[model samples]
Target chain A: DQQVKQNSPSLSVQEGRISILNCDYTNSMFDYFLWYKKYPAEGPTFLISISSIKDKNEDGRFTVFLNKSAKHLSLHIVPSQPGDSAVYFCAASASRSNTGKLIFGQGTTLQVKP
Target chain B: DTAVSQTPKYLVTQMGNDKSIKCEQNLGHDTMYWYKQDSKKFLKIMFSYNNKELIINETVPNRFSPKSPDKAHLNLHINSLELGDSAVYFCASSLTIGTSGAYEQYFGPGTRLTVT
Candidate 1:
């Protein structure tokens, strides 16, 4: 079973515009949500994250909003740049599990048009 | 310097062959993990080691084995490789496994394995 799901397979946005990527999870036990950006042939790099206790977390141009009631989270990038084009993966983990195991969603490919 | 490094960035082998992928982290982290990304872009955890001890082992095949000789190194060895084994494998490291959300994983440039 896919605990986490990214309904959209791909997204396209223009540079200098806002881009949003959405993710949903079936497991309410997940306490932490994270986003990673991956370039072709490279490993995923951390982007932003939000805890279950917080509704939103912001890191510069990247912002993550979490809604525990809806079991959903989203990553928003304002004024998207061409360099922001890459695959974005949504991941979640139950921190208390101690194993640090993460359940990841099928990644969403973001294309920022220059 | 690379935080996590994997040797043999690309491996192409025939079915029924045996191959190993070596991973090392210089970040002085206490936890290391192995993840596999298949053609569908699904990143799944295969194994995790903390301080040279196995912490988590997913329901992977018996043909796949993970060895952590020390805290900084974790290696994956595959025996009798199958066609389904072709994918990109990633090695990652984190400071600790806790509920504090400080455990951000840093990943190495992945090793692409193609089995024919």
Candidate 2:
């Protein structure tokens, strides 16, 4: 069963516009959510994360919003740039799992048209 | 320097053969993990080690064994490779055991294994 799900397989946005990527989870035990960006032939790099206690977390142009009641989270990039175009994965971790094992989504490929 | 490095970025082997993938991290982290990304783009956890001790083993088959000789190194050895085992394997390291505080993982480039 897929505990984490990214319904949109791909997304397109114009440069200087806002890009929003959505993710959902079925497991309520997950208390930590993270977003990772990946390039072709490269490993995923951490972007932003939010804990269950907080509703939103921001890092520069990137912001992540989490809704524990809905079991959903989103990654938002304002004034999206071409460099931001990459596959974005939403991952979740439950602290009780002990090993910090992350359950990752299928990933969403984002394209920014200049 | 590469924080996390994996040797033999690509490996191609025949079915029933044995293969090994080596991973090492220089970040002085306490935990290491092995994740497999399959054709469907699903990243699944295979194994995890903490401070040279096995911590978590997912539902992976018994043919796959993970060995951590030390805190900085974790290796995966597959016996009797199967065609279904063709996937990209990634090695990652974190600062702590749980996902709290500076626990963001650093991942290696990844090793693609193809079983024919």
Q: What is the DockQ for all candidates, taken in turn? A: 0.83, 0.77
**Tens-place lDDT digits, model 2, residues B32-66:** 99999999998888999998888889999999999
N/CA/C clash count, model 2: 0
TM-score of 1: 0.98
- Which runs of model 2 end up more than 4 angstroms from their true locations? B99-102
Worst 10-residue lDDT window for candidate 1 chain A reads A93-102
Reported per model, the fraction of native interface contacts reproduced equals 0.82, 0.73
Question: For residues A1-114, could you state the per-residue lDDT of candidate 1 as single tens digits?
Answer: 999999999999999999999999999899989999999989999898888989999999999999999999999999899999999999999977878898999999999999
**Which candidate wins on DockQ?**
1
